[model samples]
Target: MSEIISLAAANQHLQYIDPGTGNSSGISEMLAPSACLNAAEKKLAFLYLDNSVSSIAAFWNFFNSNHACALLSSSMKQEFKDSLETLYQPHFIYDIKRESVDGYTMEKINSSLEIFISRISSGYSVHDELKILLSTSGTTGSPKFVKLSEKNLVSNTKSILEYLPVQSSDVTPLNLPIHYSYGLSVFITNSVKGGKIICTTKDILQREFWSDFEKYQCTSLAGVPYVYETLFRTGFTKKKFISLKYMTQAGGKLNEKLVDVFSQFAEDHNVRFFIMYGQTEATARMSFLAPEYLQQKKMSIGKAIAGGRFEVDPVLHELLYFGENVFGGYAESWKDLNSYRQELPLHTGDMATVDAAGFYFITGRIKRIVKLFGNRINLDEIEKVLNEQFHDSSFICTGLEDQVLLVGVKNFQDDEKIISHFLHSKFSIHPSVIRIKQVEHIPLTDNQKVNYTKFMEQHGD
Candidate 1:
């Protein structure tokens, strides 16, 4: 039997409000389509979802049923989405944008959504423990996915709730997408134990988003580093939201200066600020710097989560994590789903150091090193230096070749020659090998991380 989440009890107190349409509904309403997905046969379903009532209902139905599903963004490109469908050949597909599938019959779930039921099976069996498949490459639509089990989800959720201060009366806006790991955790943690959830597609930059945030009196805000950066640049910290009790940051390392700025703001306002660290491989979170120690240990990733532990490889200095939430390996094709392979003691690929208090600091990425002119360079370090120097701009560094490095900058007003000159003067990097590309905004994957893959493609690399 599947370890399905029974909403019978949670439904009584769970209230879902969609600010877009001014609609308020109970969790029980999400169960209306449960029968369509609860068929006795075990199958795989593809759920392309957005933050909306219908999408939530479909996702809950598939999750509660015995079926295994892959959660994808509804905004995925049609060709990329079609490619995955052809590769996995899922038995069912729920997409807000799709009208029909080649060998499937369509059922209209709502005005904005439809369900596609395949006419024939793909002749593949899904592992009993496989419950969710999250894309490894985010919006790039790579076939690689991290496989997660029900135990992984439950364990991570419990661990997060242990440290995150959320209450039954709190209200939170779904500021992030549901497909991203951090975003999914925000939704699940709030749904299972927190309080009322406001479902909206509006992002932080939109005026309508702030309007809804104020109208609903959102109690908590969750964001990645990019989101936080945008908030700080937009004078968000200067303003006050009385309903906001706390804030959560993850997805990437926020600059130390900005971390201190936000920590001080949170302190003055009596709001808790949690700096967390994790990857999709570990479900969502592996560690979090507690609000109490934010000022003293602003650079630390803090201690391990409630049930997770971290270790640094003696030789490589790479960060390692051990926990129930560690994913059951990865899936690149449908055939790989035949069984679950637990690749434990996850090497996080990040080089880190731990202090006497057991607090961890991420130094750099092991894979981010590149050879340029017989000198090894760390791309992450270059980015950190440039970002700190050019506080008004954002920089992403990538080595394209043995002697060539590309620096992608956004919101930069200075001459490109200045960047090259600075690199040559400071790092002894020759100007001939330094390439600079400026953009109005740095391209971000659907999950809101720097889209290095897309950025590289822009240069035809």
Candidate 2:
């Protein structure tokens, strides 16, 4: 067992608080009822979790047990959820949202949570070292899962803690979904401090979220680029949260202008603002820019996390990371779970360059390039250009071998001509190859990332 999980399970000072009901329960007490699961042999369990105490308690219950668990979102579509259930054939299905599965008998753990036990054996052997399975596709419900072991989780947790200042007296809110890698790391890292964790489904846009945050005196916050954008538009910089000591951003890159704005805000308010870089394959974080360097290196991802090293491929210029936290491997089916692949020297698909001081900056994704008229055009660069130009709109840029498909969301459909003129003026690309479409809302993956794959599928024909 990992030391972090063991510490959390045994710590009586660690409490999971439900802000909705103002109820609090110690970790030992919350995890006590599910001790029967630990008696079982090595098996596979599917955990559909949310941001509530019952769901988190159920997760810790299975995590501490010998069984390997797959973390999934509770709000996943029924068909997609059923597809995964059919594909994996897990022996146990612990669901917080659904009532039952077709081939499984439901057993209630609490009023809001239940475990479905399979009627027949799955006849599949799960590797002993596999601790957790996280989906690579955010909300797309892809069959692929990144396998993580106890070592990956613990190493990554310790690396993040080496830079983050989490105290036992601090209060952290579970605003992000635990099914996502970033959210899971936040939960595990804070658990080590044995502090009060506020479990709620409320987001920053909700009035209830602020009420609970102020009520509990929450000390820190974390979000992705979109969350920060919403915060900036909603006047977050003007308001003062007396208890906020630090903020962290990851999941995807934030615009350089926004980074500067937040950096200045953090300076003015005496709060630490961290710009982090990570992926699900690394078990959460790979690098973090120290708050002190935000002003000087606003575009850099800073140095690698503790116990990790970063290098760029000389030939391909792709970012490469070597760390104990690299995932075991990817599993797409039941048979894939039988063997654990300890693949190392993770190859991040993004092209990056490291400076003399060792700070890393991602130029673009290697796969996000389109060739048109004998010129290689970066799709990510195009999207960034359009997004920065049109402050009120978001754009998704995708393309084939020689054509570019640009999809705009929010009041920019007729700006196609303007976009074409700009691209022609900027990149010297012909206007005939560029096509634009308008949509009310851009599709997002389960983790709230821009669904570029879906966009390409919809518009790249």
Candidate 3:
């Protein structure tokens, strides 16, 4: 067996605090190398790692023991789990439900554990031929398993740390899942640096969330666009986060209004709001909008990180990323990493343009652009325009056979007034406007992406 180090040894003097409660778990005595070795002897592979920082640290220690490790999000649906079973055929499964660890069925538990232990003892390297499968968010189609190496995870984490700069004194309140590349990166980077990680199961947008932040004295927070949207709705004023030194937003584009609100909030609170851009393919972060230039280049995704470069292909209007942190390739069957150069200088599939200041701003997905009246119109650009005009309204623009349809889900006190305003707005290209009931909840994929395919299937072609 490979030499294993305990989390206590690695994170000496660090205390693991649960933000929801006042309880604290000290690492100096809790995590022992003997416990890790015992767990390893039991053959724990394919553990469903939870979203907490402590669980992530435990998993990392296991991985360091040279066991084949595959991370799965606790939030994955039954269908995704079923698909993963068919592909990887994991020997053991770890379920991270809420803030605790749960075991699997007896038959599954025994057989998988034996198989994983036997294989590891026979000199098989989990980081070598053994697979570490990651599922894509399934925004466009069925989620596929992307195979990665131990080097990929370690290298990517190192690369991100090089640019972001986390110190041991920092405490990151993780709001994202550990199964997710974004969430996983947060856990790994912080733990490796001996930083304090406070685990919380409470929703970050709730009124009680601020109290938890105050209780824990959280210095950093990371979230997706939806999380920030909830904060905006729940009256997230600048005064609440006096202890927060830095914040990050990712998973999707931050609407211009939210960007302005967050920027102003950061200015008042003396906190840095980093607007980052990334996908599952790149293991999480690929680019980050600099906090210093948040006001000057509000919508920009900023530049690439240390080991990555972002370029705009003018001919195709596709943003491409080239970096060592990029995945080897996607796997359809979770058998092995596919040998393909197709993703090199990885085509991000999003349309964007770089300004003279070198800030990159995404316009829309290439597939989302509509050819209207012989002119190309980006749906995202139109949505941005309409959203700015009507703050309380939600809209989606889709292209039909020859005409464009704009569906507005509005919360306007006077719907007619807002519709009339859009009818005369210069941004509107004389397209059809269809007003519908305000959407209480936007359908999202397991990865929190807008489920457009489901939307079209439910609504219309």
Candidate with the greatest lDDT versus the true structure:
2
Off by over 4 Å in 3: 1-14, 20-44, 96-132, 138-143, 206-208, 337-343, 367-461
Better of 1 and 3 by lDDT: 1
Question: What global local distance difference test value does model 3 have?
Answer: 0.61
Which parts of model 2 are misplaced by more than 4 Å? 10-12, 33-35, 109-113, 367-461
What tens digits encode model 3's per-residue C-alpha lDDT throughout 1-461?
A: 22123432466536566765556655433434434334443232555555454565455444654445566655555455556655645445555442321223322222112112222232222334332455554211133555655555666677767767577777777677666677777876776664677776556756565677777778888777767877788777635766678888887777789899989988888888889987766767789887999988888999988778988887988999987666767665534432422257877778899999788998777566443432334556666766777777666555443244545454656645455355334433453433343455555799987776665555544
Pairs clashing in candidate 1?
Answer: none
What's the TM-score of each model vs. the native?
Answer: 0.80, 0.81, 0.68
Model 2 per-residue lDDT at 34: 47
Regarding TM-score, does 1 or 2 come out ahead?
Answer: 2
- lDDT digits (tens) for residues 434-460 of candidate 1: 889886677889999988778878862
Q: Given candidate 3, what's the lDDT at residue 149?
A: 56
Question: Tell me, what's the RMSD of every candidate?
Answer: 10.3, 10.0, 11.6
Instruction: Please give the ranking of all candidate structures by TM-score, highest first, separated by commas.
Output: 2, 1, 3
